[model samples]
Target: MDTIEWQDFERVELRVGTIISAEPNVKARKPAYVLQVDLGEFGVKTSSAQITAHYSAESLVGKQVLCVCNFAAKSIAGVRSEVLVTGVYDDENRVVLASFEHPLPNGSRLA
Candidate 1:
């Protein structure tokens, strides 16, 4: 794996956000959800996430998740994805979200 300097890691805007809303991204070719996350000072940002294999829209609301917040927005399946909701691939190649164990203030940086 490539090694990154501490500064490089710090440049990444890893922040906490709560899922205010989640719904099916019907425009997506593969199954996906359109999420609206409240990031405190950052306000609400949208993300198009392919996590339906393990999560449901009802199960995702109010969930606290880590996000890569600074990447430029990309258009995905008709939605403008703002932040990237972080997750890892499971053994079956389905995305399992990175979540906090306790409630955190929205927009808190990951240190």
Candidate 2:
């Protein structure tokens, strides 16, 4: 794997955020959800995620997950994606969220 300098890594804004709402993204070709995340000082931001294989809209609410908060907003499946909810692809190729065992304040930066 290519290695990045600490400064390069630091440029990424990885933060903690909680899912306040989630709903189906009917316009997406593949199954997906539109999520509104509460990022504390950053306020609520929207994201389009293809995590329907393992998560339900109801199950995602109140769940805290790691996020990439500084990425430029992009359009996805007719939705405005403001943040990327971080996760790893499992054995079955489904995304499993990167989450904390203990609750952390929203918008808390990863040191």
Candidate 3:
């Protein structure tokens, strides 16, 4: 494993955001969703996530998720992905979203 200074870790903008909307990403070769996240002061951002194995568009709405907010925007499939919705792969190799049980304000930095 590699170690990093606290400052280096702090530089990563890990924030919580609510899923405002989600829909299938038709252009993606693999099944995926195009999500619109409400990031409070940071505004709404878009991301393409391959979480179909454990999530559905209807189930994701109103869910609060962790996001890597500082990464540069990139085109994923046909969507212009902005923030990176954080998650871990399960034993089945399916993505399980990093989520919060209690509601947190959108754009709240992870500390």
In TM-score terms, candidate 2 sits at 0.98
What would the per-residue lDDT of candidate 1 be over residues 1-111, giving only the tens digit for each residue? 999999999999999999999999999999999999999999999999999999999999999999999999999999999999999999999999999999999999999
Alpha-carbon shift of residue 92 in model 3 (angstroms): 0.9
Error of 1 at 77 (Å): 0.6
Where in model 3 is the C-alpha error above 4 Å? none
State how far residue 82 of model 3 sits from its true place (Å). 0.4
Give the per-residue lDDT of model 3 (tens digit) for 29-110.
Answer: 9999999999999999999999999998999999999999999999999799999999999998999999999999999999
Highest lDDT scorer: 1
After superposing all C-alphas onto the true structure, candidate 2 shows an RMSD in angstroms of 0.5
Model 1's alpha-carbon lDDT is 0.98
Go through the candidates in order and give each one's C-alpha lDDT.
0.98, 0.97, 0.97
Model 2 C-alpha lDDT per residue in residues 9-90, reported as the tens digit of each score: 9999999999999999999999999999999999999999999999999999999999999999999999999999999999
lDDT of 2 at 20: 97
What TM-score do all the candidates reach, one by one? 0.99, 0.98, 0.99
Residue pair clashes in candidate 3? none
Error of 1 at 41 (Å): 0.7
Among residues 3 or more apart in sequence or in different chains, the pairs in candidate 1 whose N, CA or C atoms overlap within 3 Å are none
